[model samples]
Target: QIRASVSDKDLDMYEKWNQDYGSWDIIEKKKKRVLIGAASVGIHHAIFSPSGDKVVTMFKDNEIAVWSFETFYCLYKISIDVGIEAFPSDQESIDVDITLPISQSKFQLMQQPLCFSSDGTLLVIVSIVDSSLFVWKWNEQSLHQQIDIPLFKEANGFNTPIKQAKFIGNTKLIGIVSSIGLFIIVDAETGKLVYKMPKTVLFDFVEFSKDGKFLSGVPSEDPKTIKLMNLKDFIKKKLLNYLRNFGEFPEKYRILIWRFLLRLPENRQPFQSLCDKGLHPAFEKINRKYPIKSYQMIKTLERVLSCLGHWSPLFAECDYFPSFVFPFIYAWPILQTFFASHFSSDEWAVLMDHIISEDPSFIYYLTVAYIRYHRETFLNMKTIQEFNKFHEQSIPTNVKMLLKSAKKIQTSTPTEIDIPKDIIEPFKPIPRSPSAYPLFSNYPVKIVHFQKKVRDKIRREELDFLQRKKVLHELSQLHQDIETDERKWIDYDNKVSTMMDEFWDKLIKDENDHQEKVSKINALETEQRTKLLKNIQKVRQNLVHQSDAFLNKQKDWEFKLDTARASLRETKIVGHEELQKLIDEENEILK
Candidate 1:
């Protein structure tokens, strides 16, 4: 994490120009500068902003100070993104490595922690309060915009808190969602869940391979190890050729055959390591023992990864290695062999689970089969597209009516206003006589009040939005809170928690010396100094008690609001039917 190329002494020149150590007048349209410093509250806690322009000694939530790169001036204070629901399409990547100072008072923590994207465009931050992620873009002079990615919200479903995230292969993000054991994956650009890694799951740190062919995660798990994962792009480009032409399948079905064809792989180190270890037995036989197509093409790609070191002993060992790798590379159809060898279907299912444990993608094919095998268990997995495909020759309507027969209602009044349905078929309209009508006394009156209450509902939603987003609203609340008795908590904590201890001790020493000078002190200066000292003292006192207060009260409202917000998204998309269901569920809950 220490990326400095210059010595601390040599870094000092750029330090002042970089970080606004003293009074700095930052103006627009000037040459940029760099700065470096440590966070305030804790010792050894450091933060260097983008370009090393200005480093905040301490973090402050809601309001953040930006230092000008050129004039070394501290710029604007800004708020964070809140109440947003969208993909974080942009990135702000900068080096924002932070370790907490020994003390909590280390300059105030800025809304927890945040990181920049590789391109220095997207900024990723987390809301520890709600356990959600927020991303923002860095525009010239200030923050561009923001997107909120609330990973999941289903009550029955599981979500892992994102401990750390790193971008891999430009498009994929190797993120650790440390909830279920440790979840790691190459999250694809399209947002479809991509490579889910087991060994990489426990990786606390990850680095790309030298040639960028693989993303490697150093072990954070027991049996301390390393996981070298190839990019899907290279795997498909180089390895798929071997899977396709080398393997054989008796089945004519392309999807089914493709699955079997992926198994034929060389058992030796160089070529076999290039394949998925747990390949299908049927396919492995066709490729390793007798390749249907010459491997002249793939050897070149393997050499490319080796820096074209074909003569290297490493390649030579891989070029000719053992052929015996149990179950696989054996010249036979394992599944058929098992059935003929007397294993029952139930026994076969149990056995296959272990055999395919190394290659989990086949689990999807099994899942689809399970869905078909048990028709009544799961209903929603079949999407509208699939339903339409079966009824393809003709399209089905999005709606259907459930009725054996239809019924009509007849409203009875003393007199009926018979407006015939057919105009031309009706008898020539008979002239009405006032006397025959005979309604001089009172007429049947029906009055109903109908109103559409829209604004009230919208107003109510706005209140809910504000109430639910306390983390996002912190910036707005800071100023008001600072003016209250609670501000004492921050002040007290910062005083003791921060380097203000030195200032405090100095003041205590000079209290009486300054008291003698109090005779010379103007009323305003005396009042100001006394007020500053008292607030500083108050901040330290509160730091002592605030943790208990924060812990007990933070989760009271924060715990469920994120779930509420996520459900709100579905209701918004699904419209009336789903919204109506939402209404019924709430009413039932309230009851």
Candidate 2:
């Protein structure tokens, strides 16, 4: 059974979430819904009865409403106004059984409602602005008024608010822890203070054992350590009655029973206001004063969103995930205090950087595990729009779970178990000491003195051995550094040599290329010269043939001229012989 409260000026509502934990179908079918509504004022605090059949809600305006668990309806309203007259002291008959009609007129309850007792028969409320406690007996429907008990006195310098008040089991004795570190037990029936135990450190909470045999508390200064104190007759009796069956109970079962008996908070709050308002401002102060190394924190924030985005479609598309450091800073107020008190800014930054470098996902798992553990508190939230509101709310119950999961995620393996060896030997009794020859047996005092000297020498030798070990360790480290430096130098040399070889090969190739070009140029020049010479020879031969043709033509013309002349002479001779032979041929004929 879970109860959720909502309040306004006109209407105040209480919603009950009920489920049968044993039913499989109920869980599988999502058969969990908020049951509607009850009327109350602005309830500052409220709690269900031990039987879960009734709920009592306290309003800030000093109105107490009792609602029935079954029908979500208000059973009674006690408007105890502040500064109202106390219950009539002479009225003894109205202590236990109050007839509803007679005491109805005194129903002006002028205090902030606190809580109901475990049996649901008593209603404890406190004044709105003072340290006055009002206890009332719920006799059926009528609330019989009781006397007001002042938790603080005027002798004290200032008023101390009651930090926590709860009934010890089903009894009428209530245990209260004040703001000033006072743990007191009061009787709820008569509003009388029973016992007071002054504490050195102000505790956040005070709790009682189930059987009312012991009371335990967690100090506000050091909430990690829980201290238990004996109560009532149990203090005198010690553990006599409890220890009688201790041997008979199995060790495993005993731990479980002991845990059940002592019902206490697993962890204390990181700070007084971490679970409430002012957390953000305090974180802002820390951020300004001792800023964390945000490089890794930012990386982790990215990784967390990326990891969650894989599973949730909304996260995959959403731009922002929650701040990973907010929960840690809230949960580790001591760390903040230490940083502020002891560490310099640079030192703290380096420390934070180291932590982030080692494991950036540490805070991621812690925040996720905390949210997962107390997911019910976030049921009203749906989207990133509601994250601002969700971050402001506190879930103290998940602190332990968050730490456990974070540690588990960070650790690699379990520590080695220390197994003890048996003292007895397998074959014979162990010798106590090793003795030498009886050189000094005759002189007892000398032997004792010699033994002392030997012991002193042995001590000296041990000290020398330790010194040598330290020196050797330092030398080994130096040697390692030297070897590392040598390896680096060797690598550098090899790289330089390889570069030189490449440069030399390139230079050789360039030189060979220059020579090859020069040879090609010379060969081309020689070929051109040979072609020029061949062309000159061909021109000479053509000129010679033309000259010869011209000379032959001239000779032929000369010969033809001679033949014509001779022919003319022959004709002339024939004419002259026939008249002295044609003259030129006539010359030939005459010759």
Candidate 3:
């Protein structure tokens, strides 16, 4: 049998009926019960629990009753107070046979006010009047949580009202859609917003899949088109967008973000193997060079450096090797607050790869920017010693500014330079000595001088490119302005013609009584057209003059760019084969 509830014409009486499932025949009719005394009072809506074991009915007067399905008895009753009056005291006991009346309505509802969780153990009620949410442990007849939804100021400077809300599957989370189509998910336990989607379109309806893996909505503008989204992918995209826009991570998530960005595998076995091998023989000079007070810190640094050396001999050959390990050690103490384990050798190796694999042109641009930033001070220095001292002091004081300026220079220019592809070759391990001792006290100075010469050439080329690029951009803008002006003139002429046609039609309709008025209108139209033509002519003349000037400037810049390109092709940085020969000569000298 199937059970159904019905209301009379006046809505003051209610009845429950039992009917045969397939035949549509009423098997039994329960007694008619007077639900409310006032004819204006009525039952608003009713819904069954998922199991159909219980029924919850809301009345027009802000009173709700929960009833048992088997006995048809009223189990509990509660009244919602929307700032009108205090809540009515609960009844100690209620007779199963009797029906009670409720007070008159106090506040209007925006939508269905309440919903049940999947298990029916909890209920969520949206209070439209106060903009609040109340979760109830309905089985226990007690309030579980109350959350006040604040109005966001950025939502068009008004309080976006909640249109509908429901529990997401069986989880302790609630998904809400506002009237303006802003969707948000909130953690029911913590009362914190976990995800929010901006209001880009108005939705007529929204629903989550049973498992809460997907959400589907019908846009109000196009009811036939349904928008379905995978919740997991949507959240990931939102996270990436936030990172791109804000470029900062919260302290708790920093390590995880760094690991993700660096693509760290965190392979434990290989890292452990390197650690077990102890310090490398090449770093035996660390005690003499950078003596430390903390024995544990020194030991940790040695272990980390040895792992790097085994991974790549190039790292062990660098003059300032300790500088790399010092940062990781300092970060280790802070990272310990979030993670229990110490930094691994695998992470260090990955960090080194990123630092060393950058394109050589990036470094050249950085050095060039650094020099130009202190160009005046260098030009003023008379002696080489003075220049060297100034260079050493300026680096420490202006390091941050120099980096910012270098990034600006790199990004602002077009990347069209034609350089040899072999410039970005991978690092090759140097042949080890028989004693496995460190090779040199400092890096080779000749290589540094060679790098400086290449940087100076690249800098001149970049300056020439920038000048040509600026002129080309200006020419493009000028062409667009001319087209825009012509479009505007055409639109103005069409508008004037339309107005004149409408005015002429009106005069024709009232011709007999307005002969003099038609003459005056014609004269006024003629004057307006003449003035418009003069303005159009003046604009055309100005545009023609501007075009002529820009064309000449464009030609000049193109010639300069051609000359720069020719010069770049003629100039030669050492070829790869020559560079290899130089490296071999240096190695033979060391041997």
Candidate 4:
């Protein structure tokens, strides 16, 4: 299905364009043109919903509006919140207040293709401005979830930004493409990453097959080849074949090849026309959007425009406009004059196109290669003018130098460890008894090893402190319970003793009264004395049993308290040792 934005207000659908030549000849009859929303806000991207009942379009104003496929009437208007006012807590926010909407240039580079699950239940939108993924429940009319794309640590010990993502309807997985050229698969429901291909490639806008068996996209190295591989079997043979011939190919062809590879729409105008009509509009849009533009910002933008003046007119309406220009402006801000002087307008366009679609690893490799090639020159440069002057050299020479130098960089092997004579002597003689062994027996022998071990020790100390803090808090609570139990036991004991004393005192008074009445009635006095004796005996037995049980319980609690105290003492000792070790290491380093 071919959906073309003919004008700002109209979108033309050419359903039978690919079927027959007769369909193209009678374009008016075959195509259906529908007016969509306002003409002022140009449509940036549009896609048919999975069900084919509705059309979703992203506008220049960053509004995502939905239109009925049959009627072309506006259904839903949702404004995309690309940039957040507050930064993520895990990250330290920049001092600059980047509250303004995302720039068209940036949005163009970072904007992801609109995607929907097969069931039409979920809609996913990726925002590069805030590095977040917004997923909507289309049928339910509510947001399903939104997740921030965190900087993922790469093999080179640096973080890479996520570039694009596509949904795999069959497997319930989302295919994520990173700027560094890695394919990542994540669970659609849970949002947890399930699989990440170690192999890296320079590709954009990946999509699943209609049957959901294979994934396909353009490769930067070979634009003509539509790279298709089974989702389960992502082999590197096809990608490696293209890489093998990458350096041997002519520089001019590389860009053109990339354009073909990306399947970017070919709507080229002359270089002069682009500068005259397009550059100023883009600049004016940028200027108006950002009210507080610094002189540096204006100057940087002008440099970009000046470079664009050399390239053929490619407007936002053109496919791959963002992918073509964004990378070059970003990667080499000061090398535009060099590029214009070296290559023709068409060649420059190709070069820009290649950069956006180029493998991220290769980009990193090229950067390292360039640094290696010009290390001495860069080191000798003193001022900004000197640096700019360096860029004035022919671009081909720099490019060639990097390509050649990168080949010469050999991987280094690990060095062998040499035992010190002083340390070797100590290990030569073994102690007869384990108890007589030196305290430094298991310690690091070499100074470098010792330093590393000491650093590790410090880190371990921090972890230990955190663990101890939690344990100590728990111990404090336990101690409070023990104190409360002890108090209860004391109170119980006092209550039992008071009751016994009161009973004994009353029994003794009654016995004295009965003795006085002994002469009056012998039989009644005997019976009363016997009952009092039996009661006294029963009370004594109960008191003895209660006292024994309380004592045993108290003993058990005391044992537990002792064990806790011992553990606390051990923790304190280890803490002191950690501090002492730090002090000793510092003193040794100073000496």
Candidate 5:
């Protein structure tokens, strides 16, 4: 379920844009105003710079324009060969989820909009008609969000136009990564294909699951299937259900069963062979002798084990190593399922010992995964020799015993399979060693200060908010006073007009009588006008003084910004000088 929606979809436009807002270029936010240049036909994308100060637009004419709105300036321009359909990459860019269906032939690539990541890390240009896709990377110096047009094939349900775009952080971005009916999810922040998921429409949109475990979409193959997951979720959910027959075993007791199921590779030859042999007829004899109906369990195991046999055929090392590494890298419950079955304490110890000794790489991450995934187990076994032996370079006797058990794990088929020999040669012998490998934290407290600067800006905005409110209040009061003054002047003008009309009407009837009074009235009016002019001048002078005070405050703020830049320059100079001195010392030491 979508938890939130994007705000501010309408880009600010002026004048002629009252109708053709789409024609405006990328709108950039600087302070209060929005800056935009022509985007050829319409503004397909609008992006704020990393600082949210400048904006760049990709135009339909294949021209890129830059704008700084706070200054009301068009700063720079770069030309592109591709048309105006560029994608915006700011973190706040819209996250679209599309499960809607559209015709593949109608999907035009030339008009499909491009996408960039929210943090300004990657740029993407999508073409629905040509079925071409491009991915550009950010590498600091040149080509910030460059595009590499991807070649794609045209087909029916297989290939369709892409319609949406999104980022899964920096390394992996999902959604419509390509045309030809594909919702590509490359590696997180990087361009590595984890799995290709299905989409509903030719332009079906894809997004990351909140937890980042699965990539789900409104399905193409099945309309009702809005959620699709990897083999892992499939198994987990299958185990989760209260089924007709999980073959036997309570839901609570099925964890170890699932773990064992995961350990069984995509292709299970042993299971297939068992189903072919039909449950070891020996189990039937044992059931008759013991009255335990263990044959039923054997049959269930046979079918489950046989299920993997028909899966994709596996080649040698190259094909399967990545598969093996994935489970270990991501600790799928390999041990949990194995132990879920009723097992003796000796058996449990033996399994643990074997995993640590023979599967050192697996064991290292297992213990780490345990600490990560199974917090309780990690806390309880925190001091266990098995987990700590990597640093100690010593294995306990129990570890050796477990290795023996793993080695002895066998099938009824015939030949003894050596676990070490079966595994790839490179991983056959992971040495026991004591070494201090530097540990790297997932999220470093020290970022490059870019994000920190954004936070500081937010804080500054909060501080300025009250100041802005005060300024607004002052302006409102000024506007109300000006309106009141206009009303008083209008009333005074009306009274003078009434008096003049009465005098004009009286003059026609009695010109002689009115001459003396009119002269005296005119003189008095002249004096009153002089006094009113003087008072108006004084009020204007007071307004001017207040205006100067407001302007002075603004100038002071600008000056502070200027001084801050100077201080920044001074700090950089000192740091540079120190670096130079250190270099000189190092040179002398080398001599």
Candidate 6:
């Protein structure tokens, strides 16, 4: 029989299947599964376990069921308890008409919220609505850990909905990405967030390689290109960015940051185990060697020193270990006391009398600057005794100038005087025998190492200070030159402005004179045209009178010609009889 199942166009399983006579048949006769008691109505998603022996189904009613694939029977059921309180209050006030469809689509396009580890030992689930994460031990079917996304308090309690989560290779660590681009790694067992990233625009999906060496994701801002980050490099760059952005951790966060830098685990059980071991033998001389007025402070110091001694054998051998840890306990009193095994109480008092600012933090800077001031003299001394002797002799002479320079250095910008790495890291003294340097065997090796570090730091600071001074001097000179040039440019600009004003005034006058001449020429031309038109009209009238008189004269001549013709015809008719009379008449006409 073939096993088959049917789903709607959206691939949401609505029916179960059963084998029937070499073919699969719908168990509910094409009807949707009915909700009965606590039973789930329909399967929204399903996935098979790595061993293919079991399957997990996410149902329509915020529930998941584990089923034996071969037996086809429900094994366990889990209800996803993402209550309304898990969602941000602001989300509820959002206009449904504006954001309903968009929010719905985001959920629809999101990946499956549940995943199994590579070995199938642990199962991880995330809620689409609130981004609440849950880790479960698959075999025991028990919840291991649960936490909200973006656990860092710095996230300011904002809801960053998780987009995808998966196990990193075969490790017990789970990596998750949020819609707002918060990438975090959490320990599956403890549920502690191990790594957190600053917010960025992240695409809908992110994944780790099979070996979990690299994590790759598409950025929403640059969707066409995929970014790959090496796990080690990503963490290193993140730490560097943190330090660069916030130059110094606040006072409250100092200890936590120190623990992080030192890679100290926060597990309480281990620290308690060390504390239970009692005080180290080396610190038995605490009451005699470094007398403290407060009994509680002494007890605290002993307990802490004992823990350190128990953690490392080297700490047990170092006689000056208590002094090294003293400042962290009673900060101000420790600064006032000089327990270096060399300086007398009288000499320390004399040095303190000259100093004005007794602030512990400033004194620390002052001590560093003091060591720097006496660097050359200390270097010339071949033995620790000679060094201590010089330190005593030099204190009274230059105490005032040293305090002034120390205050200046203390107030200097962080960039101008870097807080050295050696200063930030906890001091670890090298193991050395008393016979190695017999001249100063009473001096703790810790102080010698500290002096060397101070000298090195002072050398670097001196060079930096000189370079900065030179730059400032150059900048001052350049500023003066720029001022001089600006003055000359202002004068030149004023002169040019005056010249341009005169030129414009002359040009305006010339244009006015030229326009006046053109106006006069136009007026004269108009007058000439009027006179010429009048003369032409007078000539035309005389021509018309002459032509009329000539026409009348021509008409009279034609009439005279016609009468002469008629007289000639009459004379020819009576030619013979009247010949004599005509001859006389002709003679009269001729006369």
Evaluated with TM-score, which candidate comes out highest?
3
Task: Give candidate 4's error at residue 23 in angstroms.
Answer: 15
RMSD from true fold, candidate 1: 55.1
Please report the TM-score between candidate 6 and the true structure.
Answer: 0.35
Worst 10 residues of 5 by lDDT: 309-318
Tens digit of lDDT per residue, candidate 5, span 1-591? 101112244333332211121212335542233233231233344454544455554443334445553443445443223323323443122122111112233223233354556566655545444444455543231233332224234444344445566655333444554533465554324343434434344334455654344556655446565755553344344433422133233444344444433343323444344356443211223233223235565344334323322221121112222333322222232222333122343444334433422433344333333334334544676556855543233222233333333334422223344343344233322121233112222233345244445655765786699689889999999999999999988998998999889888877758865787899899999999999999999999999999999999999999999999999999999999999999999999999
Model 2: how far residue 361 lies from native, Å: 63
lDDT of 1 by residue, 304-407 (tens): 33321221223222222322221232323223232212233333333343223223333333333333443553364368776444332221211101000100
User: Using lDDT as the measure, which candidate wins?
Assistant: 3
Error of 2 at 102 (Å): 26
Model 3 TM-score is: 0.37
TM-score to native of every candidate shown: 0.27, 0.30, 0.37, 0.31, 0.31, 0.35
True-structure RMSD for candidate 2: 30.4
lDDT of 4: 0.55
**Per-residue alpha-carbon lDDT of candidate 3 for residues 348-400, written as tens digits (9 for 90 to 100):** 33322223333445555555675788788778889999965553441332444
Clashes of each: 42, 29, 0, 1, 32, 0
The better candidate by lDDT, 3 or 6, is 3
Please give the lDDT score at residue 332 for candidate 6.
Answer: 41
Instruction: Give a tens-digit lDDT track for model 4, residues 1-591.
Output: 334322222334332222210111133444444342234445556666766666676655565667666555556555444321222432222222112233343233345446777777888776655545677777765677776545455557554666777777444567878776667777667775555565646665577886455888777567687888676434223232444556333464455445334433332333334344444332444445333336675545544564353332233222333334433433333223324444444445534443334433333444566666668888999999998876665444345454445434312212242222223332122222322222332333465355545655765786699799989988998999999999999999999999999999999999988887885578777888999999999999999999999999999999999999999999999999999999999999999
Overall local distance difference test of candidate 6:
0.59
Q: lDDT of each structure? A: 0.39, 0.50, 0.59, 0.55, 0.44, 0.59
TM-score of decoy 5: 0.31
Give the Cα error of residue 335 in candidate 4, in Å: 74
For model 6, residues 457-479, the per-residue Cα lDDT tens digits are 77578768979999999999999
